[model samples]
Target chain A: MYNLIMKDVKLGVPFIFFLFPVLMGALMLIPGWIYFIVLLYFCWITVPNLFNQFKAQNDLMFTSMMPVTKRNMVKARVLVIVGLELLHILIAAIFGVFTMLLYPNLTYLFFPPNIGFWGLGMMMFAIFNIIFIPIFYKTAYKFGWALFFSVMAAMLFAGIAQWVGIQHPVVNDIFYGTGAEQVALQAIILVTGIVIFAAFSIIAYRLAFRRFLRVEV
Target chain B: MLALDVRNVSKSFPNFQLRNVSFQLEQGYIMGFIGANGAGKTTTIKSILNMTRLDSGEVHILGKSMAAHEIELKQEIGYAMGGVDFYTRSKMKTLTDVVKRFYANWDDKTYRNYMRAFKLDENKKIAELSTGMKVKYNLAIALSHGAKLLILDEPTSGLDPVARDELLDIFQGLVADGEISILFSTHITSDLEKCADFITFIANGQIIRSGEKEEFKESYLLLNGAENQLNQVKDRLISYKINSFGFTGLIQADDFDPSCGIKAATPSLEEIMVYFAKKEDQYV
Candidate 1:
């Protein structure tokens, strides 16, 4: 199962590389601090697409034929999602740091373009993963449209967050202000995001394992 | 001891339902699961593997309930599907590596031997292999796992005659050990006639008949006679059909009366299957 997850990750690298220029261009439009959020959106959308392909390949049937249990299958897929999420963060963080150094004077609207941004990005990814993975795992082809709509809804929520960040003065000061207080706030959000991601991933795993147990090949 | 015992097993879906399906396959025996297209052959296999949740009934493999000991039961069973789907980009070596990590008893020597016998290129991606080669690959994987019971669903659907014969030979060789049992589902009855020890017929999601191969052969007689002669034997017939040439009916092969001047011929498995499939409509 770990091998299977690695295979998915290897298969996804090409797509991620192909999206580099577009993702870099999108980053130029946003403040360096919030670039991580956009990167999170990219990871959220692309990882599921890769997993959708994996599911459609009928790996479940083949894997189930092995001595492995259905519970192991569900665990492998969830691990793959989490692994890909981390890879996305690592790559985006590298590019973000490069952008920050290249344009030092450019003002960041939120936390600095460093670990703080990656933290927020992880939080956003966690929210999407928790909601979407279990749903897709349950009714893959059947609830495909539902998963699509849910992804779109996540993107919409991200858009709203950006909008609110720009409009509200107090919200803007707390998030975009350049000080230790702002760093502390970002730290809290990052920790909360990790906690949420861990909690939801576990829940999703249990639901998906039980649901797939009943699904006919 | 029986290798598999499915006792009073029934599964229901919205459109189709399998009712009271029961059969037993003993060790060292090959039981052919014969059915038409949508006869629930795949469904029954899935239920036994615990791939699909069964509403009622129990499936026991090697004296253990599948529900209670699924992992242990599956470890001893090998399965191949009618339509095999693999990761197109991965090569056979990669697949072997991945599968080898999971099964403790995977025989690498047998795997290598099968690769050489089948002439399967280890470096070539699975998507590039022909359908026949894909089936061969599936067979190799199923066989190399040291499995005690083999369950195949339509394992010989699209192969040419030569390839089909080769597969049947492989199955025959595997059963020569006299400890392995096989339950294969196929629409092609000729294959069963060649290698099967027992035959089980299913139609309309029901087990119509199941018994030893020779017993099944002796139970039904395929008679060809003139229209009037067929009419004379109609009262004793289980099923009959009228065509432009004459009338043909299935009657008790043993009880067939030659006094009526109607010829009683030994029926092949195919003819027996057609007789049962046709008999259902007449009886219902």
Candidate 2:
């Protein structure tokens, strides 16, 4: 299983994709930017290209030929996806801190990059996983429709969360404020988001594994 | 001990179906799996490996049921599906480095030796290799893993005659120690005639015959005679093609009548397949 994950990273994913998170993370330097688009870049560029590479390289057949179970194959792939998602989030989060330090007084029309904000990002990626992994496994080859639906679903989550942060007075206070009480609430949201991400990802893995078993390749 | 056993295996697609496909290859022998295109050759291979969910029946490898012990059995079974080059953008060494770790008995020295012997450059990307070279690279990997059974599908396709002959010689050498068993599937029967000890013939998703190569050939008789005698033996000829001189046809050895006055000779594997293929067409 470890070997399979390594194969996905070393062969299935191109070197440029590893650098995408850093390049996209630089978007954090933009003072008071719509931070969600930074993460959306991953969905827009990396996910489609990565899946396309796997399809072009005949990854399903290659991995199937190995002495591994279909279940493990799905697990390894999910781990790789989750790993990349986390990388993108972490890199952008670091840049988010630099933005905060560089312009502490600069404040906001949108949901600022805060603990609560990252929690929302996590949930958005969770939604993408829940939708993308299962739909893509339906064929385990063609991913265009899966990518389309997943990116839309993730962006919708991001948009709704951002809208609520702006429109709801209490929600806006918690996201925009820096009080100790607000910080504590933001920490709780982050934890909740992580839990949801883990749960959704596991569900996605199970669904994808089941679909892959039925696939002819 | 049987190296591979497939019993009553069947799979159904929307357009085609495998009907009670059954064959077995004993240890240390090469069995040629000959079939025309879309005859369920790839499907049957997929079923044996449990890559395709079987609608019915079972496959056993090395005396163990594939359903119960697929991963364990796969350790000893090396499979290469022809023409499918995986991870084409990746270098050969990069792919090998990842694959070798999966097997417990993977020998790096053996792998290196095969890479050198096959003239495969480790730095060359898979897409850069020609079709024949791709086959060789597949074989090199299949051999390096200490596999006891090799199931290769059309490994000889698209190769020049010399390259094909070289591959056949390599196959023969692999089984010379009477340890490795090969189930080679191809439409090219001439390669099998040179190396295969047994033959399993399939057509239109059914197993036509499976036995010793000589018995498989000798089972049918090729007949040639004057065009006038065609009427008497028209029913017996499995299929016949008319020519300028007279007509030639394929008939079961048991169905051939010496008193009918037609010259009878044992058919080659190609002749047998051609006749069986013609069986589907309207007799001319």
lDDT per residue (tens digit) for residues A130-214 in model 2: 9999999999988889999999999989899889999999999999999999999999999999999999999999999999988
Q: After superposition, how far is residue A49 of candidate 1 from its true place, in Å?
A: 3.4
Scored against the true structure, residue A118 in model 1 reaches a CA lDDT of 51
| Every model's TM-score on chain B | 0.92, 0.97
Residue B282 alpha-carbon offset, candidate 2, angstroms = 3.2
Error in Å for residue B173 of model 1: 1.0
Q: What DockQ does model 2 achieve? A: 0.83
What stretches of model 1 exceed 4 Å from their correct place? A1-37, A40-45, A108-117, A141-143, B233-236, B252-261, B280-284
In model 1, pairs of residues that clash are none
Clashing pairs in 2: none
lDDT for each residue of candidate 1 in A141-166, tens digit (9 for 90 to 100): 35465457556655665667666776
Q: Is the docking of candidate 2 incorrect, acceptable, medium or high quality?
A: high
* Candidate 2 structure quality by residue, lDDT tens digits, B1-284: 89999999999999999999999999999999998888889999999988898999999998999999999988898987778879887889888888888888888888889889989899999889988788888878878888999999999998889999999999999998989999999999999999999999998889999999999999999999889989989998989999998999999999988998889899999999888889976632
